[model samples]
Target: MNLKIQKISILLFLFSGLSVFSQIKEEQLILDKKREPEVKKIEKKKTSVESIKNYPPEEKSQNPVEYSITNVPALSDFQTSTLQADDISPNLKTDYYSNYVRFGMGNYGKILGDANVSYTLENKLEVGADAHINANHGLQNIYAWDSRQTSLKAGAFLNGYGEKGKYNVTADFGQENYNYYGIYALNPASDVDINQKVNAFRVKGSYDHFSNEYLNNITFKSSFLSDRFGAKENKGALDFNFSKHDLELPLNDVKMNADLGLGLETQSTDFEILNTNSSSYFLGNLSPKVTFIKDKSYLTIGSGFTYLSTNESNLSLDRKANKTYWFPKAELQLAKSDELKFYAGVDGGLSLNSYASMLEKNLYIVSDQRVTPTETKYNVYLGIRGDVDELIKYDVSIGHSKVNDILFYQTNNLFDTSIAAIRNAYDFANTFSAIYDNGTKNEVNASLQYFPRENFNVSGSFHYINYKMENFDNIYNVPTFSAELGAEYTLLNKKLLLGFKGFMASTMVTNLYDVTNTGLSTNYTTTEQLNTKFGGYVDFNLSAEYKIHKNFSIFAIGNNLIGGNYSTLQGYQVLGAQILGGLKVSF
Candidate 1:
C-alpha cells in the first residue's frame, strides 16, 4: 500500500508502544481509609457507596476498585468494591483535624496540592471549600512540542440539617491545560497553537430525607464546559429514588420492598464547524424493582426503561441518537455464613455520553464532535466475596455484557490531500477521536486485602478484559489486562509510616488508514492496519510520612522508583525517578 507518499507516512507512525499505563506511585494519603466516589454518575441503577459530607478524603486518582492515583474506566460500569487502602497508623489520633492542607513539588516540574476547609456555623449548619492540583511541565529531554499539562479543580459547599431531612448545595470550577505534543512535534507547524485549554463549571443540590413516606433522596446537577477552540457544551441532570425496605411478605424467610427510581438528562453542544451542525440530546429513565431479604442473604428483581430524544445529534454509524430501550435487572446473593457469600446478577442501562464523561476517559479527545449515549444492552455476572481468615479478605467477580454504542478511543487520522485543510489544531495525529461500536465485553476483577495487624496492611488487585466489536478491528489504547499491589507499615508509636505501590498492564494496539492504488491511477482505495504497538511496562512508587507535632506532619514521595519508561497515555512519556516532599498542617 503505497503511492500517496506525502500522507502515507502516517504508516511511519508504526512506532512501538511508548510505555505501560503509569501513575505516580505512592501510598494513598489524607486519611488512608479507602472510599468510593462521592459524586455519583447516571451510568446505572445499582447501589453505590453513600456520599459523605465534609470529611478527610482518601487519595483520589481518578475510581472501580477505585484507585486514589488514577481514574481510568476499565470495565465501564462494572465497579469493584475491594480496592482497600490500608490504615497504617491505627494508633494515631485523627478526630481533631477538622481542616487539612498539603503541597509538594517534584521533578518534571510536577506539582501536587490538596486542601479542604470547613466551618460549623451553628449546631447543625456548615460550609466548606476544597481544591486540588496535579500538573507537570514536561519530561525533560523527551519530546519537543512543549509537553506541559495541568489539572485544576476547586469547589465549595453549604449544608443544612433539619428534623425532616438534610440539604446541601455546591459549586465547582475546573480547568485542564495541555499541549498537543506528539510525533508531529518533530515537524514544524507554525500556524496553530499547540496548547489546548478546557474550562468547566458545575452546580449541584441534594436532599436526604430523615423521614418520608416514599421519597428517600433526590439530587440535581448542572454543568457547562468550553474550550479554547469554538467547542462548548451545557448539561443538566436529575436523579431521585423511592424505596421501602421492611414490608411483611407471605413467603417463608422473606420480606418485600418496593424500589423505584426516576432520572432525567439534558445536554447541548456546539461543534464550531459549519457543515457539522450543533446538536442536543435528552435521556430519561424509569426503574421499578422488588427485593426480598432473608438471613444474611437477599435477592432483587427489576427492569428499566429509557427514552432518548435528539436534535441533530446522531452517532457516526450504526446507533441512532434518538431511541427507546428496555433492559433487565436482577441479582441474587446467598450467604453460607458471615465469612462467605456467593452472588450473581444480570443488568443493563443507558450511559450518558456527555462531553465531560468522555474526556474523563481520554483527555485528548477532540472537542468538536457529536456526542451521544452508550447503551449497555445486558450484563450477566457471578462472584463470591468472603473473609479467608481474621487477617485476610477477598472478592472476585466475572461478567459478560452485550453493549451498543460502546465508546472507545483511537487516534484521529491525519488530514490527507483528499480533504480540505485542517480545521482544528488537534489534527496533527496528536489528538484522539471517540469511537463507538456494538460489541461484547468479558471482564474479570479480583481484589484481596490483608489486615494482619493494626500498624501494617497489604492489598492487591487484578483486572482482565477482552473486547469483540462489530465495527472495529481491535480495541484501541485500552490494556487487555492490568494489576496493582501495595503495602504500608507504621512504627515509632505510629508517628512514622512507610509504603510502596506498583502497577502493570498488557501491550496495547492502534490502527490507522493507508492508501493503495486499485489497479488504475484514477482509482484508489484505503485499508486499515495496525500502525502502532505500545509495549507493556511495570512501575512503582515509595512514600514516607513522619509526624512531629499533634497538628503537623512532613511527608516525602518518590515515583517510578525503578526509572521505567512508561506513559499512562500512549505517546506521552512519564518523568523518570520523580520525588516530591512537603508538609501537612491541621488547625
Candidate 2:
C-alpha cells in the first residue's frame, strides 16, 4: 500500500511540470503572432514611401480623375458579304492560212488570176511558188490597145542553227511578161504589138557568228543576181561585217559600239539595140562606223570609201571615179512617253541605179539607155510619232535632202523621122527616156491610223514635196502633193469585210514636142516646144468579201467608182468604172 501511494505522488508531480512547460510555449506563440501584424504594416508603409519618392512630379495631381465619351457615331445597317464576277470575255484569236488562189473578171474584158503555195520540209527548209496574171482588152476610148502582165516566182530557203552561229541559203527564180500598149492615144492607126519580158534568178547565202568577248559578232554574205531582158545584166557581190556591241568606254554612263564593213561587187550589162554594146562595172566599198550612246541620245560618226570602175565599150575616157563620203548620224529623243515621242536624225548614202531597176520604175524606158549611180549628200529630218489613245496613232515628219544625179523620166525624141507618114507613126511611139538632174528636195509627210472599234479600221496619209532643179525650170511628171485614204470594216462575226480607198494627186507637168531631129536630145533649138499638164485627179475604189467557209470566200471589187475620166501619166488614160467578182480559196 505504501509503495503505491509514493508512485501516485511522483506521477502527479511529473504531470504538473509538463503543464507548466506547455503554458510557457503558448505565451511565446501569442507574442510572435502580435509582432507579425506590426512587421507587415511596416513593410507596407515602406513600399508606399518608395513609390511616392520615384513618382513623376507632373503626375502628382490633386484634382479628382474624370472620364467622359462624346460625339459617338450612330450605328446603321451594314452588309456582311458582297461579291461579283467579271463580265468581259477574252479576245478571239486569228487563224492563219498559208496558200491561196484567186480569180476574177471585169469590164473591158479584164481578167485576173493569182495563186501561191508553200511547203515546209524537215523543220529547216521552206519552199514557195507564186503566179499572177492580169489582162485587159482595149477600152472604148483608147482603141487597139490590149494590155497584159504575167509574173511567176519560185524560191527555196534553208536555215541552220548551231551552237555559236547561224546560217541561211536561198535561191529564187522569177519570170515577168508585159505588153507596152500605151501608144494608141498618140497614134491610133499604128500597129500595137509590142511586148517586154524579164527573167531573173538569184542565190544568196549568209552566215552569222556570235560571241560575248572582244569580237561580238561577225557576218558574211554572198549573193548573185541575173536579169535577162532584150538587155541582160548579171551581178555578184560579197560582203563582210565585223561588229562589237556594247563595248566599254572611258566615259561614265556612256556606251560605245563599232562596225566595219567590206564589200565587193561586179556587174556586167549587155544592151541589144541596133548593135550590141556592153559595159562592166567593178565596185568596192569599205565603211567604218562608231556609235556613242548616252541615255536617250546617239551619235554615229562614219565614212564610206568607194572605188568604182566602168569599162564601157563606147565611152572609155569618163568611166572610172573614186569617192570618199563622210556621214554624220545623230538622234536625240527629246521626249518619249506612252503617248508621244520626238526625234531627229540625219542620214545619207550612195545608191546604185541599175538598168533593171530603172526599167522597173518606168517600163517605157528606151532599151539603149545610160545608167549611173545616185549620190545623196545628206538628209535631215525631224519627226514626232505617238499614239493618241488606245485606238489611234499618228506620225508626222519633215525632211530635206540634197541629191546628185537624180533620175527622171522623159519622152524619147530621137525616133527616125524620114517619111512624113511613117515618121509620124514612129514619132508617136510614146516611149520614155531617163534623165539625171542634181536637185534639192523638201518633203513633209503625215499619217494617221484609227481603230474606232474592234472590227473597223481607218487610215490616211498626206505627202507634200518641193523639188528644185539646178539646171531646169521644171521637173516633169512629178506631183507636188498627194494623199491617200483607206477604210475597212468587218461584220457578222468577221464573215464579211468591206473596204474603200481613195487617192488624189496634184497637177504634174509634161512637155510635148515635134520630133524634127534624130538622136535623143533635150535641146530646145531642134524641137518645137509644147507644154502640157496631167494629173490633178482623184480615184476611188470599193471592195467587199463574204466568207462562206473558214478557208473559202467570195469577193467583189468596183474600181474607179466615180466614173471620171482621168490620166495618171501624160498620155495613158485609165479605164472607166468597172466591177469584178472573184472567188478565194485558202489552205
lDDT of each: 0.65, 0.57
TM-score list, all predictions: 0.80, 0.72
CA RMSD for every model? 12.2, 37.9
- On lDDT, the leading prediction is 1
lDDT of 2 by residue, 1-587 (tens): 75676456445533543343232110000000010011110111111122211222222232332311111111111100000000011011124655677777777676666565655555434455555555555454554644444444555655554444446676666655555555622444435455566677777777655342233333333333333336777777778777776777989978987888788877777776633456777778787888887765567777777777767664333355555556545555554453677878877777667766765456556565666677788889998876655577778899999999888777665365343433322245466766789999899999887777776667788999988989867787777887776666666666766665566678877665553433354332236344467657666555667788877888777665555555555555555666777787777
Kindly report which residue stretches of model 2 are placed more than 4 angstroms away from their true locations once superposed: 1-96, 145-172, 184-192, 204-229, 238-242, 246-257, 274-278, 292-297, 313-318, 420-427, 515-526
Model 2: weakest 10-residue lDDT segment is 26-35
Candidate 1, 473-503: lDDT as tens digits: 7888787888887666666666766665666
Q: Could you tell me which 10 consecutive residues in candidate 1 have the lowest summed lDDT?
A: 73-82
